[model samples]
Target: MKKGTELSGLINKVKESPKTLQKISPIKPTKDETQFSFWIEKMLLKDFKLIAIKEDISLKDLITKCIKEYIKEK
Candidate 1:
């Protein structure tokens, strides 16, 4: 039999044995597929922390605010 047929037969055999097999699906992040984040060193992070405090906002909130404001200005 062809490789595809052989694989399909094997899959069907596995499917026939419900107690011996389980299906799995991948879980993906919903946020923009192109979006990404990275870690910074503690010292640099502390600097942003200071900026955030000076700006009177949480670090996470500050990032959103800054980016939004930048986009608005542009």
Candidate 2:
């Protein structure tokens, strides 16, 4: 019975962790973005990630910039 009570107390503390974390860092505003996924060569993705890191931008941002430029040229 004592062990069961201690387990329930631990569970309650675990459930409260998210609230504590939210107080420390409020959630960011939602971005106008959606998930996009496609198959690419393994080495190509590795190179792309390296470029994105060097540019200090996200992979999605780099891809979006490229696509927008292509559309503008067309």
* Most accurate candidate by lDDT: 2
**lDDT computed for candidate 2:** 0.89
lDDT string for model 2 (1-74, tens) is 99999999999998874644334667665997777789999998899899999999999988899899999999
Cα lDDT of all candidates, in order?
0.84, 0.89
Candidate 1 — which residues are off by over 4 angstroms?
1-36, 39-44
Task: Please list the residue runs of candidate 2 whose C-alpha ends up more than 4 Å from where it truly belongs after superposition.
Answer: 1-29
Tens-digit lDDT string for candidate 1 (19-66): 746678897878654554988798988988999999898998877777
Among these predictions, the greatest TM-score belongs to 2
